[model samples]
Target: MLLGFQDRLFGLTGSGISVESGLATFRGAEGLWNGYRLEDVATPEAWDADPELVWRFYSMRRRETMAVQPNAAHRTLAAFEKRLGDRFYLCTQNVDDLHERAGSQRLHHMHGTLFQSRCVLCGRTFADSGLYERPDSMPKCSNCGGVVRPQIV
Candidate 1:
């Protein structure tokens, strides 16, 4: 009897919960990610061959991420957390901060984050400085000249 009650008392959510936060759900139809397949921008080989190109791609994504806002789904989850107390857990696959902005105190980003950048040489991750409007020739890693890459999965 206790086990049955516990099973019905827990709340489980997947990427769908975050989809309501105005974030692009990758691997879905009309996803914001396209062009230059993952092979060209998401692998060790790609980083080794062309770090600048990879940085550029991630930088563009960061800029776009900054422009979006949390949607109703994100807001609803936050509200649920308020009511569920400690029984609610949110797991998001998206890198955007929509869930955070939506007031979700208990959440996890399994993939990674889009608003943060990591040093290619030192592997140090830090928040983006909101300095993405410079020319292509500009924007080098603050810690190292190795170029900053988005900390995405």
Candidate 2:
């Protein structure tokens, strides 16, 4: 089915677009991360109860995401977008910024973005510029002075 897509001028993509870019799919038997369950750390309740642990997990993921570059598939889609302009649309479930780094101007993040943080109190979202080694340091919301957490989904 993918081979047939090459001739088409416009198309949509999913998680598959990022798999080749070194992002792991959070399914299957081997999908577990460090023996921790996804539900335990990837929920609003988890953040409310233990924000530090949740921040640790997301911070490590952000570090890994920062290490990888966009692969051929991402670059191809970017080139396609350049050729098709507004006719092409891209929707990605992966949170890494590879698609954006690959020059994809027309795209949407269905799940969320890894490089963004949100305030737990007021629910305000913003870009995270700090590195992962500083996980112990909590980000304060410029709007409400509340601690901010990464908005991972």
Candidate 3:
């Protein structure tokens, strides 16, 4: 369709795309819901009520994400981006780093990223791949000294 009329492509990826990489989908057999509920660790109120607990939940997820690699689906999308250049747009609901690891430069993480943290007050975001070595240690925004939360939806 590049020369026909519409000369662009849009690709949307979700948790399923990362499942083949041995990662759990949101509602799959090995999903996060197996042990946790949204109200307990995936909601803003949950974070507000117990930041530590929320952090703990995400920390486990970070560990799991780190252990896996990008699967073929991720690589295919990256290849499409490479071939199409600006003509292709990719938006993903997954918060993992698989797509980026697969070399997809032009991507939009609509659900936020797992390895990133943003300041709730200052709204500044930066890469944070640490597993927070110390207990009771939470990231703080350097600008306004606000609490940093996971960049996930």
Candidate 4:
């Protein structure tokens, strides 16, 4: 549908965006590196092996992300998108929604976002931002009564 545009501007972002906003990177010595392993929290197999642990990690991430704001780089990309309109597109590897917070309307998250979840049963995805401190408090899918897992990729 965007084939009509003669000019296009594409921006790609990664962990730098999160780091610039004070959201610790997983590989950082001060962050998840201290307590978790990617094999235990980042893979689908990891999620299947220990859902509660994965949930805890992701919940902590959501809380941390909610506390921070987008950095200058995010704002710059957003501004460029605003000026260029539909001619601009942004693809981000970070799961956080800093790009959206910075006013970027045309963007895609290459990695799944921390704010969305999908049912384990039917794969119906939906918006969710609340933190679950325990397995009992975890969200249940309204569509099929299955456990809703985070969309983190």
Using TM-score as the measure, the top candidate is: 4
Candidate 4 yields a Cα-based lDDT of: 0.85
lDDT of each: 0.66, 0.77, 0.85, 0.85
Candidate 1 residue pairs that clash: none
How well is each residue in 1-153 modelled by candidate 2, as lDDT tens digits?
233334545455666666776767656466566687776667888777877777777877888788889998888888888876776788877788888999998888888888999887899999895554454586789999998888766
Clashes of 1: 0
Task: State the lDDT of candidate 4 residue by residue for 1-153, as single tens digits.
Answer: 233447788888888777979987766764353367767787889888988888888898899999999999999889888778988999989899889999998888887999999998999999999898797888889998998899877
Instruction: Show pairs that collide, candidate 3.
Output: none
lDDT of 1 by residue, 58-88 (tens): 6666666677777777787787776666766
Worst 10-residue lDDT window for candidate 4 reads: 26-35
**Runs with alpha carbons beyond 4 Å of true place in candidate 4:** 1-7, 30-34
Tens-digit lDDT track for model 3 on 1-153?
243334678899999989899987866654454377756778889988888778877887899999999998899888888888888889999999999999998999999999999899989999998675355688789889999899988
Return whichever of 2 and 4 wins on lDDT: 4
TM-score of each: 0.70, 0.83, 0.88, 0.90
- Model 2: worst 10 consecutive residues (lDDT sum): 1-10
